[model samples]
Target: MNYELICGLETHVELSTKTKIFCSCSTEFGGEPNTHCCPICIGLPGTLPKLNKAVVEYAVMAGLATNCEISPVSKMDRKNYVYPDLPKAYQISQYDMPLCKSGWVGLSNGRRIRLNRIHIEEDAGKLVHDRGNTFVDYNRGGVPLIEIVTEPDLRSIEEVQEYVEKLQMILRYIGVSDCKMQEGSLRCDVNVSVRPVGQEEFGTRAEIKNMNSLAYMAKAIAYEFDRQVDLIQSGEEVVQETRRFDEGSGCTEGMRGKEDADDYRYFREPDLVAILVSDEMRKSIQKQMPEDPQKRLTRFVSDFDLPEADARLLIEHRRIADYFETAAKGAKNPRAVANCILGQMFARLGTEAEKEQFEVAVTPEQLHELILLLDSGKIRMNLVKSTLEKMLDTGKPAKEFLSEQDLAGMSADDLKAVCEKAVAENEAAAADYLAGKEKALKAILGSVMKATRGRANPQEAEKLLADIIRR
Candidate 1:
């Protein structure tokens, strides 16, 4: 029987606050085992928790960026659980009164994943297991986090990946968190279920916890869905439980039975006061929010006339989009600037991480200078491309590599003489051109460009070569 996979994702994003959410401890990653923790973060008996103001503002900005409504009033609650990593045993978080509500992120496939809520919470610490011995580190304890819960709107693995990627791009563009999955700054818990095709009701769902990377998450979801379907087909019950993805075997092993809300035993925390976000504060944060990547993508297409695929590449990262706009502002053809970025510059950046960091030696202003050279028609496109490579390699400005002879440009008479010489040297190509072979003209044009050392206008060279071959 055909079955459809149903899935929902719970994404936990660590806010980039200097200090932990409820304490003054450093929230930096990769410190000595417990060096970054403080008495308050470790939940000493007499210590009381204090909320970080930056955490609230950052969460609100994230909500706004994702089309969520900012709650005017929200309060913190206690989520009680006994885990070695959670120093307090009860994490201070928002429950019924979350800071953001009813948000949604649109996917490229015309599907919208509706967010249940975005709640602020504190992160637990790390657990290191070495040689069958377990060690706990509270360095990440009390680190600020925003948990984005989505409804079961994801039906396929493609949608799951696209939704996660879209969320990452939006979160990074707003400068909230780095969303470094490897560092555990961002992770997802996928809830997977499967039912027969055309089944209206969702089958029992299994929760897979702490998927750090997208590729692994996809594999986990695919494996879990099939496991659930196989159970239903064999007439065995599909129990709802927590599972872990076994990377080595590409299978999911059961961890424990899934717990409901009552299992957490949530209660209000008396240490912190009620949180209030006035319209004034919301407006201030809205002003600080960057332009939506989608809106900027539309502008790139409408204003710069770039192809949609190329525009998508530019807007993938905020810095790359910013650089392209800055350079295009001074160029005669914005499309040329876009082409240079999507074609040559992107080739230099080898990986996704490199593309995200965008650590290029060429400055946006220097790229503007290069594009302006093309704008003024002083140098041909081939010169622009080659000079750009030199500028990228040596971190020098375009003027340093562009000699006077290169920018002086070939005069019309000199260009015609060169084209005549190229046709005379390649008689077979010139004869082929006369025999109605259009590609033969390209061979002669290549010689003209080589003789002129890429300073010749391609259009003018092709035209001159065609006229010379006809003669």
Candidate 2:
């Protein structure tokens, strides 16, 4: 009676547009409650909705980036629901005909997860419930969102995680959306079911909602599978329902019985005009689409001669990849540039939050120049990282900080003097070295590096040490 779990995910990524999907309201997040709302987004009387051209273009870009087949035509339908957050009592969305469909994202394991559809929709406002009263904020109303639904091709929790990571990276690379899960710009709802190993039909599926993180999604699915298996073993039938993922308890709790599609009573909007995407428009979007993450990953590995694992890590963020590309240009060692950026410069930037904060002020060009200067021996590696931190903290450029701190790399003459001084001081180690003690030479090299305060070129120091030892 072995049972296997089946999983699918529905992810909503808010488009990074300047305005609302069907109105002129600003799409900025964390604004004053209802400050960005207008008559149309608030569903005031006699207001007609107009689609944002940027929204449609972003959708097409996303579709192409994900290997989806962009539909020739699509239109918005009204999804009716009764929540205080929904000012219009209905959401404008795509139903039968969506923006794209039949796409697939291949995993590292060679398993392909099929995309059911990617549809555009308007996000609902938010409801902040207090002790006694619930307040409705129309700030989020009418914001553009793309709903990406995947087929039930996922089997284990690990597969779901890989599929999600790859998808998020692709979206970020294409410049379509920011896909920040913590800020609620991206959200996921997972459907999970289990069946006997040989069973042809799936068991009752449980839809888990409000899973904000990848770790939470995997844990929630794993917990649900265990709960279902236990029920089936005890001869109790699994009931379909909508469940909430409790972060504190790390378990799924029933929110309500699963609502049927008819519960929303979806219909076409009468006020808005139908969208007509011509071949020319589709071609324009296809041309504008940036390189896909997977494609870029492969290219980074081949073109830059990076290890596959290193390329993957570098490509995790668009800014990081851009920095690597810029720094590698006309440099002696692109691999060294990659290593210094990730290993030293980034580490000097501190935590993820600090890095993001620094990113607001520091450009990739600045970091690229720093890497080049350090790699070419224009500045010592240790001083380069220290100067970068000062540049970030004080808003000073790298060149200015380098001059003020006098942290430049040692000149060949200065390095030779330090190396000579090191050999003069460490007579015991030098004696041991000349007496056929190879290990003692390494100790003397360390002394030379220390004497120069890590400013001397390590290679030059090693050469000077060996020259002295041989003499």
Candidate 2 has its poorest 10 consecutive residues by lDDT at: 353-362
Q: Which candidate is the best by lDDT?
A: 1
Every candidate's lDDT:
0.90, 0.83
* Residue 180 displacement (Å), model 2: 1.6
TM-score of each: 0.95, 0.87
Model 1 segments more than 4 A misplaced = 257-262, 427-441
Candidate 1: minimum summed lDDT over ten consecutive residues — where? 256-265
Q: Give the Å shift of residue 11 in candidate 1.
A: 0.6
